[model samples]
Target: MAEPTGAAAPGFELPLLLFAGFRSIIDDLHRELAEQGHPEVRPAYGYALQAVGRDGATASEIGRRLGVSKQAAGKTVDRLERLGYVERADDPQDGRRKLVRLSPRGIDVLVRSAEGFDRLRAAWVRALGAERVAALESDLRTMASADAFRLDATSWFNG
Candidate 1:
């Protein structure tokens, strides 16, 4: 609803507050994930991991999904490999291409992440009550488009 006439205009705090809320949830998730032995995981790694998917993907494909250059995606893959989070294999369909697949460690981390998010959501339900939380999620869904639900959100948001 619009503010009444003569009311003060809104500043940037609304967006900032929304971002802060998101940052808080993500930060809490990461903290818990670190405690679970994924201290090396970074925020960016989640997007990269999602892009790699269960079927595996090439650096180029991951790059496309992540809205990053192939070189950048390859670097991320290299780091993930060193961290034991992913492994590269020769692509069966294309001899010249390599597919980046999540290793056991990667799969473990993702499983842990899902559990962590569920716990976090449950905590929110406890604090806000289930109906309010459900309404909040529904409202967010109403505001956000399916097209916005992409791993390439960096470019989507920036552009």
Candidate 2:
């Protein structure tokens, strides 16, 4: 066996750092949900819930927004339906397609997740100062708006 050596490991990038931060926040939110007696919820499920908002949406739309396949989105919907978080109904405009919407229980989860995010934001503000946090938010928004880094996801909305 020969020892092969190549380039050194890459250093942390801004995207990776941001993703790590998001993961941490989501993990905290999941823990909070569990503490509040909602243990079936997961971070990925939140994305699906957001995609299927009050107006409801099709699995194909969700998959497009989430950067996943239609089958993957359908599976997420199925899991959520099994968990009593969402309901699927035939689309009025297209009987062949189905629209998914959050159930009352799913709404509760959404509310709790919003509260969790607020709590996390407050903690960050307390630790880093409001001005700094505001500046960071603005910078992140600017970065997101850049033409080179367009993100097309409905995860930001409380859907």
Clashes of 1: 0
Q: What is the per-residue lDDT of model 1 for residues 1-159, given as tens digits with 9 covering 90 to 100?
A: 355479665777667767877888889999999999999898788888999999999999999999989998899999999999999999999999999999999999999989988999999999999999999889889988878678986555655
TM-score, candidate number 1: 0.90
Model 2 poorest ten-residue lDDT run:
149-158
Q: Output the lDDT of residue 155, model 2.
A: 33
Q: What tens digits encode model 2's per-residue C-alpha lDDT throughout 77-122?
A: 9999999999999999989998998899999999999999999999
CA lDDT for candidate 2: 0.82
What residue pairs clash in candidate 1, if any at all? none
For candidate 1, the per-residue lDDT at 158 reads 52
Alpha-carbon shift of residue 99 in model 2 (angstroms):
1.7
